[model samples]
Target: MNSTLQPTALTEHVPQPVTRTERVQTIDLIRGFALLGILMMNIPGFGFPYTRFPLIYGTPGSTDFYTAMGIDTAFSGTMRALFSMLFGAGMLLFMAKKEDLASGHSVVDFYYRRLLWLVLFGVINAYVLLWPGDILYAYGLCGLLLYPFRKLRPAYLLIGMMLCMILPVLRNIQNTVETKQKRTTYWEAVKAEEQKKKLTDEQKKAKEEWENQLKWTKFDTKKDAEIVRKMQLGYGQVFAKLMPRNSNIESRGMYYGFWDMLGMMFLGMALLKLGFFTNKLPTSTYWLTLGLGYSIGLLLGNIQFYDQVAYILDPGAYVDTHFFSVFDLYDLRRGATAIGHASLLLLVYRSGVVPWLMKALANVGQMAFTNYLMQSIICTLIFYGYGFGYYGKLAFHQLYYVVAGVWVFQILFSAVWLRYFRFGPFEWLWRSLTYWKRQPMRLQSEPVPAAPQTALF
Candidate 1:
């Protein structure tokens, strides 16, 4: 008795990967939907040197213009918002069980280990793969700060989320004020120069600032051409060109965007804790959420879209007329839209009318990590010089053809791959690394375990 141990004693406290039966199907479905939707916004960045000018890419009211407008209105930041929220929910899911603590294995250790690996994967995605818009690095870094708040009440998490959002809103206000000041100074300086008057230092600085900003926002054919040429260079040359941009995004951009991601994550945690992501809420509640979320989100989103169209038509006038009011509510619009999207999808899932489509999407979501990296690899190869070298050649609307192809491939591939395997390739690798052991990969011939009808949360 003193020397022996029961089977439960040895196995019950060991940490393990989430089984398929334990997964929340609604979460997977939403994730899969978000993964595909992200490509709608990302395709432009993949195929074009700059994505600001639908007017230049195509005439006003053309297919390109409408495409850009539609994407801006419907997707833009919404897919990423969904992903961020899901990531937060996942953190709680990972730490939900406390049995590991009894076996001297801290869940915190596993969580950090998972995040560090994600950080490395993000580096590989951004630097090695040359995808400057990669979100993994930002997510990994932000996730490091999530563990401390895991046990907070849902209400407290919501409060934290709102608090975090305040920073980005304030930043928008600051940027708007600074931009207006720069424009005023530059115009005054222009008038003074015309009168043969000496320019003040502040005016000179403002002129330079405004011009630099124009270099990015205002279309210049020559600059665009140079970007195309660089993207069409050899791997080493392209990497050299992309390095600084990726560095800036990883450093400065990540810093500024940290609170945004963190806030969404907090919201995700709150939602999961409240049973929103698990589809445990009442049907009427979901209906009400869909109604209110879309009503508010679309209203604000359309206003922002109108401003975007106005900017495309006349940047100068758009700047003069548009303050940061709509921009300040950017988070709210996307956040609401994301929630609406989730509600609609959940309603559909609950209805069971599109079982095949839902099942396929859930499979895709299950393999989301692999599919995400695959998108980067496939898109870079298609657009970069070392492969197809089609960068900057496709119009705004044409890129969706590529997106549609990727979606078809990923959906089919995920369904087939999971038939024989328990996890996506990357997911298995990540779990293996986190556990410091090779987790099971291949599905055995045993009877499939039925999924829980309700989520643990």
Candidate 2:
């Protein structure tokens, strides 16, 4: 009797992907929105070098400037934040079953395997797809740290998030101080040179540093041409050109971004535990959150956008204002905006007036992994050398045309694909590897269940 019981208990807790009936539509809907919104910010990176970012390609009050301003104010960091939060929520959902939690070892094994594969996929995305800004590697590494925090209460998770945020905030403050000092030193060096005095080593170094920073920010026709040339080269040459940038982003850049991602993940975990993602919270709560989040986010985002434009227009005049205003409360502004976006979308989902759009978005969210990779593949083909080689040809605002096209394709493709298949292509591979067995792919003649609506307030 004891031997039979042991085998039965182990079999009952075997890990598997969440089935259609088990999914939370609200989460899928929000994730789909994020996946689409992210392309707005990513388009510039796909079309131009990093140095060209935040640089308006049109005259003041032109379509280009307005587009840039709008993205900066509304979509810039919020989409990524939402995506990261959902990833955190996914961690909880993955381990939520009581039987799985009780078995412990099987769940742990599956989770780690899933993350490791993600890290590998991240590598391929960066090196092969040539997207230096890939987030999967960071997500996988940070996720490894999340397993230990899984059982912590929501209050404790929130505390942990706040603690995790402190370092990035402090770093931002330190950056502001350093930028002011560098500007002061550079001016002093110029004054000493005008007076015909020999330069001190510190002043010389400061002048060099300041000029180097300007080199990236200021428009130079020659530099732009060079960048375009490199990007429009053959695959091997382009890969070589991108290697240093990609490596740095994957290493040093990853270090700076580490705390930001981890803190957001903690917040995601906390919010999920508090029933925010599942739509279990009161309508009044979401309304309040939406109002407060947007009020703060838009206010701060506009201020930051103004400073960015000012500095871009006249670096000498606005450097101090830009540096000081932008980094301070940067995280808070983005976080608030992200929450606001999620709240607004959830409210829409609750309304039931746009059921068709919601259903399409839910399908997109379900295939987010595939859609994400697909974006990278499609963008690289459109802009990179081996494909159309349209690098640097499109203005900043024109990039959105590409974004719009991608959105339509993904939404339609996801909707149709899910009608016949159980998982998105990449998701299927991920699950199969995690479970160490082949999983079902095709849906049976029995119709897939529609995602259920939440209780109305």
Candidate 3:
């Protein structure tokens, strides 16, 4: 056993492609898209100008709506799916090659090191950086749970993933129905209280304040004092009400999200086994899948878009008056929509399309672990009190300008950094620490094993 071997390393004993295929490019291309598109979702969370977290929970302007419908809806929801699928695909490729290079070490042991590294990176990103929104934490947590199921049949993994994705949706539906029923009861209570007219002035004031806290807190601040009071009262209620739900959501959310990611990752693994991502599929098949996938997604997205608008305008009263709520809410489309985007990305890979863009994207992706953390650090400095303190001050439209500026910096810096170096700075450190041995940082004269290929579906 070469104690120096890495799960991401290319080995001589690994099989070479007989066909003129570009498997590494395929993964890189998909990863490239995932890395860039993830910003669409994350930019909003960087500051208060975009759609608020838990999405659908905040006020947004025309720019926010357009961003949601166009960029965020088109790419944000699906890109992570593509990224997760590539991860799964990579996992399969890594496992396949591990058999050739290392016999004694278990895949679980190998993956534990990887996940631990990821978690450590994520923790640093969350606590040290200004941005607390960290996907690494989520991904690391999920990656750990996925290792044991690696040997399961592809069909079983797919079924398991579907059940996992569905759990959150079902829970959301149950909660929505319950909330709707409770709102009705709450309104009835208010009406009864109004009729009785027995409450003291202080009680009335307190009740009004509670209602304002629940519904109008988003717009309540005009000064630092108001902001401070709002933050305290807001957090107090959040801890009082939402903290109980947090445990429930985090438990189930992590499970569902993990399964969803693993399902795609494993599907990617299975596809790699079949040579789908390695460009082994027929050209005709690629285009057909792309067309079908995008068409279905566009149709569903439109339906969901209309539903959100109707809900925002009238809520129960509008839906009750019209038959428009027949379509599913945008929030409910996460699973299917994610799958649809992944399908489209697969087609792009199969066709070997967009070579230059893919190269830049791959460069970005190669350094993704670094870039992901860097984004948090940079954005936090721009938005938080410990840095720029611009968090709640920026408008929805202005946030787009900030996002654009950051994107330009990341892309240009990524391209420049890769030219002089072999890997992103953090990536170099991660591989070095993982193997407990020094790995080549630049392309050496010695033959380097390319990233492993994927199988056609």
Candidate 4:
């Protein structure tokens, strides 16, 4: 194997086997790991009250808070970054293959159709399925942007990645600074209204508006209970409440995430170009990657997670908003940790340290699409009012039990399904849609790849 980072020769490009035939087992395993790990991060949101989870508020070092913080430190932004990067790498793989397979129609047309379908799926997930945090819409939207950058040089891709990654922090800083400015003006308006002199109407109105804004920003006991009330009513009712928040820029999901997803995808493309995901790197390289990435990433991730949790729970009138300025550097930590995690998984597999475990995880990754959507269905059935009515009933820590159960079931189910099937149900549907022909879903008469492109990137 060549050790240097260089492009494959023109002769290396050949007709791809098929879009549905996944050749990269390592990518599948990593994707499966990221998909499962992400659920750990999302379980709280699905099982407990939004914004205010199972926290003994203001108790920074308590076991409850520490447990949640620990989980966040381990997963949090890292898994999402890994997932996004993997998507980018998959895009490169898919396009590379499709370019060879294109005949009468253009490959770009097929790519657009795939993205548009994803956007449709995202809509269904968000509206009908009622997961406000459904990421498919964001992923598809960013993916549309990715097409133009598909053929960009690795150096340019890295530059694009840096800009996308950095923009969110810059936005956060702008928001924080602007928020402080509003606080200052809010107090001034109040002070003016309290003065002995006659007040201007604008100042009086400003006082009322700013006071309301301040009141709305803080989540108190009553607000938390009211949120629980809305969610516990009916799925339709909750849907009405959450649609705006998930779709718009002002909402937390889009606000914090708008650029970060694109940046991570670009970074993934760069890494894939470097052959980092191909298990082509030397063992020494993998070991060094694991060491430096985790050390630098996890340490910062821990401190930042702690501070954010503490700041959210702070009851002080003068909360330190500056602590949130740490968002500027948070992605580097997350991206690093994600890389560290991928390094560990790849190293483990390459060394044949735990071959059976690798095969199981790879199987799960192969069925990732079906498993990912199944998570949403199962979680909602457990948490929503329409299902078991466990809405707002569980603490953040308790949600992990449900996640663990699903994790076990998915691993086993995927393995079992692949034993007799060509693809997971959803994967088949996606492939059928992409190719304009129904894909074979059952086991073939002869020996065949148990799980083909079902979960393949």
Candidate 5:
């Protein structure tokens, strides 16, 4: 009866230990989610003729309201932010490992070499490859800039990131104002041209055909197949050199998506330094962050998404007058929303929700460097002429199937391939170049073996 619990009985125990490999699993999961999200966003452009911007900026609300609003904001913008953050996190990891080596030589040399190679890879992807919607070039270029800044204090890096984020917002506003003014002038000219080209019955019919051709260049595959051929073949000789109505300013990937990527990267770097990735935060804190972010981001995100849909349906006074200006507030709102989304994702990974799902995501993530490019490669084959030539044919909703198909393939391929290989093909090449030595490509050790199942992140 005097037997009070012994001190040993009261103590808690730390059970199993995690290896370096398991620690990397978290990173792989993050990358997997990011890569998948990216595919979701890019699928539209891959299947559609894509006459305009694939993102909401080009053609708002063309897709279903729910799809446009729910998917675009939640997945498109936010996922991209997550991916960029992962990239930044990876940079820190790579640098840290190098530093841990304590090699007599500086790691900066190898760092620059990797970035330079990445830039080259981006260039190849942009021009020589299929899809022009390349982010590697921007990442490579900005990452090069980040080289010096990486060594700066975390606080300074955060400040620099804020400035970069603001720059894009300001530029967007400026462009919006200027675009409205120019569009008015352009519309008037187009109307006047239509009037001047008034023609006789036969000429009028021919003119209508010409106008249609000008709009899509691939219109009327039945009777006007010849015309379509001419348009396609002559595209190089005729319009290839024709100056874009707008200057080269927007065409450059730098101005379009570079800042977005940079913002995410900086945030990632800051979070990584803050120990966000190290599972240091309380579970309650993570849940609270996710709840707040999802609520605010989803609410605002839905509003903007619906706004785009409404604008597209009627496209009346508001469409003509306001256009890119209406939801200026939402653009900034997206940043807040992205924070929430990123926070939630991090929490999931830390919490070890679904171990199997996390493992799958991590597998895909481990091969992310390969999978990212593989996406572009596979998408180009699915959409472009050199492959199936299905581009511009599939409807918005129909594109989802292609995306789903690709997702299944990627997951299956990643899991199976990883069973036999150490790193993804491209990942291995990257490591080899980074280390200046060939890396082992096969599994040198047995699987760690799965543990008791739990909820996945």
Candidate 6:
């Protein structure tokens, strides 16, 4: 039907509020779910550094170790995978609207303009805000490359998704090799220094160089303490201390994230075209998806759980240069679990299992852009020296309490805000910029939908 519609003919519908009655609420609900769920994984990084790792391995049955393991095994990459696919689905939705408006206006303009702004936002987040693990930069890059693949058949899209995953796997392998080489070189230098009866100038220089190189490879409590102090000193001091180590911009920002994120985006597009996101699939199909996805994914995930635990805990593992072993199958495990999650969420949504909860989640999803930025701002202030200065203070498990608190606040705030306003504050700004027109914000003039008589609890 959209193919026959003139672009100008659909002008009135081009930028309608996503909350309108005609919208598919399930997508927004999942997005809202993702918006909150992601904090479960990200709180640690916000409180410390993303690269900050444990010096000693976890005790098998200990509280801290098992907590860390559970979080990583269940959530870490899964949330990111789900979030990336959702973004891809959103893009496809936007394109579908454009097709219906095929009035010859430059869809390219819309696509590029939105992603270009997103790229700028990513830069600010990474450098100015000093959140080194920011994914927006990576998303912008993936999105720039995704527009051309929009019309591919599902089979072709799946093929493309498989191809996109290769580079991240390769990138991880490359990192593992480089880490091994660095460790070997550093240890050899130490051995040589130990053997020397008198320290020669050349040998001393070599030892110092190797020591510096090894500093980043090992986890040192003293180094972590100093870094924490710097974070407490001021924002500028923290920025100076951390920026040099922000190498994710090189690795993840380049090939690794490009592959990992774009692959999921491709999968999302394929799924959307197949009507997966629109509740077109049967409940039985979703149940089977849930069963198979969780079985395969959780199996792969748990297989490495102990190995990863052992890798971090065993000093011998690091000394033996086997630190990279844990990540060997990271990509595949995450991909499987991500599908599992998507299936579970879709099944619940299609079943109308919890209308009130679903409505709240949809509100959150509609305002995800606003809430994401909000989280960054709030957490930085809460943890940095500039605000309450709680950086690097909490234990791994306790940090989640902060996450829970934030979620409660966001959900309650979002629900209340959406009742009166058509868009979240940041969403309105982004939409205005993307359209180059000031969109409506207040809902006072619009007819209000009748409120439910009963309380939601």
lDDT of 5 by residue, 1-457 (tens): 0001111110112111112243455455666887887787878655553443223333544564346555756765766677777678667655543232234445566666777777777666655553455667667777776655566667876786787777876777886665555445455555756899544554544445434434542233453343223223332422332223112422564666677778778877786666555445566776776777778777777777666655444443443666455366543455566667656666766656766777788788777778888988888677665566666666666777888888889999999998888677886776576657676677764345223110111
Q: Each model's C-alpha lDDT?
A: 0.83, 0.80, 0.56, 0.73, 0.60, 0.70
Minimal lDDT window, size 10, model 4? 1-10
Question: Cα lDDT for residue 311, model 1?
Answer: 61
Alpha-carbon deviation at 20 in model 3, angstroms: 17
Please give the lDDT score for candidate 5: 0.60
How large is the C-alpha RMSD of every model relative to the true structure? 5.1, 5.5, 7.0, 4.1, 9.7, 5.6
* lDDT (tens digit, per residue) of candidate 1 on 241-318: 999999999999988889889999999999988889888888999999999989988888888877766665565566
lDDT per residue for candidate 4 within 201-260, as digits (tens), equals: 656665665566545435568878887787776778777777786566324566567688
Name the 10 consecutive residues with the lowest summed lDDT in model 2.
1-10
| lDDT tens readout by residue for model 2, 1-457 | 0000001222233455655654678888889999999989888888976556545732568888888888988877888888878888888766654335444555668878889988998999999999888988888888888988988998998888887778887887787778889999999999999999999999999999989887765777777789999999998998998899889998998888888888888888889878788787888999999999999998888888877776666666666655556556777888899999999878887888898988888888988889999999999999999999988999888899999999999999999899899889988888888778777788773234322321100
Instruction: Judging by lDDT against the true structure, name the best candidate.
Output: 1
User: How do the residues 1-457 of candidate 3 rate in per-residue lDDT, one tens digit apiece?
Assistant: 0001123444444232211122365565557667766776777666663223213323345655666566544654676766666677666554554444344555445556767887777666654553444556667777776666667776776666666666655665675665455455455557769799566554555455445434422333345344423223332432343344344444555664665566566666565555555556666666665566566666666666655665554454542454324343332344345545555665554445765565676667666777777777777667655566676576555777887787778778888887766667777677666555565665442244454343110
Segments of candidate 4 deviating more than 4 angstroms: 1-22, 54-57, 98-103, 193-219, 249-256, 313-324, 445-457
Between candidates 3 and 6, the TM-score winner = 6
Judging by TM-score, tell me the better candidate of 2 and 5: 2
Model 3 residue pairs with clashes:
88-265, 272-454, 272-455, 274-455, 274-456, 275-454, 275-455, 275-456, 276-455, 276-456
When sorted by lDDT, best at the front, the candidate numbers are 1, 2, 4, 6, 5, 3
The count of residue-pair clashes in candidate 1 stands at 0
Query: lDDT at 106 for candidate 4?
Result: 55
CA deviation > 4 Å runs, candidate 6: 1-19, 49-52, 99-104, 174-219, 245-252, 315-326, 445-457
Q: State the lDDT at 204 in candidate 5.
A: 45
TM-score between model 5 and native: 0.74
